[model samples]
Target: MQEWFVDVAEHIADGDPIYLACEECGQVALPPRTVCPDCAGRSLEQRPLSETATVTAETTIFSSTPRYAEETPYTIVIATFEEGVRLTGQLRGAETVERGEEVRLGVESDGDHWLITFTPSD
Candidate 1:
């Protein structure tokens, strides 16, 4: 995994999530980036994420490799933040969710790694 990705997760675990915004084109990216993907601008800043996101897509995985078999039947969602950045993460606090549903972004740590988590907004 990318170091920047881990950094973002760590921030979330600490109650702060961030998105990288381009100082030039105003484009935003969820995972931190050194340069703007749109304008190739090197001036990017870390901005606090909206924390809440709207579910745009979802799916449930019933089968997976042995490493993830213990966590089978998990739900994954693609949620859009207020900044227009879409983030994909594991769904928590519910077995499933629908499009347009509200969810809060968070982080889950499992010893050596961090993962993005999306739980019901309320």
Candidate 2:
């Protein structure tokens, strides 16, 4: 899991689009993948992910999860990129966001490490 996080961090730093490549099936998947769901492959290649995406759905979480204690009652969105991959991340720059909103991906440093986030477009 740490290795995965490191890979994501490096990809964000390079400003390159992220993707996952399946070793067994040789399929390139965006948003990264632990395994090839199609072929049940265990080996995966992590690469940078795209920054542009559209909000497919969103909701505000009033209760905090164990990992996101500081982010209670925060808005989270499921964004679908042009590559047809979906990802969930923290939503920023707004008190309220809606479905179909165009957003861009960004990396946020949480003092120790970086995490993905969604920023609303102007």
Candidate 3:
């Protein structure tokens, strides 16, 4: 797990927000990809992501999920970036975040890993 976290941090430090690319089809996907759903490609490329986006959807989880008790009722948001990449992550620093709200990327350390968060745009 430590190695995984290190890798993730390194990846984030090297290039972020990462994008997904299909090696077989040479198609560039805005959000990072594990395998190309369109082409079944096993190879992928991680590319830098645009910093700005708009919230498309959001939900707050109040249940006692492990590792997130302090952040219960935390906002989880899906955002579509200016580059047309759609991604989901925790929404931070807002009591209420709504759809179509502008957001920006913020990084948070989770002890084990660094996770991305969306903050309300100023």
Candidate structures ordered by lDDT, highest first: 1, 2, 3
Error of 1 at 34 (Å): 1.2
Stretches of candidate 3 above 4 Å error? 1-15, 23-31, 40-44
Q: What is the lDDT for 7 in model 3?
A: 52
* Candidate with the greatest TM-score versus the true structure: 1
**What's each prediction's TM-score?**
0.95, 0.73, 0.71
In candidate 1, which residue pairs clash?
A: none
lDDT of each: 0.89, 0.76, 0.73
Error of 3 at 20 (Å): 2.0
On lDDT, who's better, 1 or 2? Answer: 1
* Candidate 1 residue spans exceeding 4 A from truth: none
| lDDT at residue 11 of model 1 (Cα atoms) | 82
| Candidate with better TM-score, 1 vs 2 | 1
- Angstrom error at residue 28, model 3: 4.3
The clash number for model 1 is 0
Candidate 3 residue lDDT tens string, 1-108: 445334544555555555666768877674445678778787887656677689999998889668789878888899997656676778988877989999987666
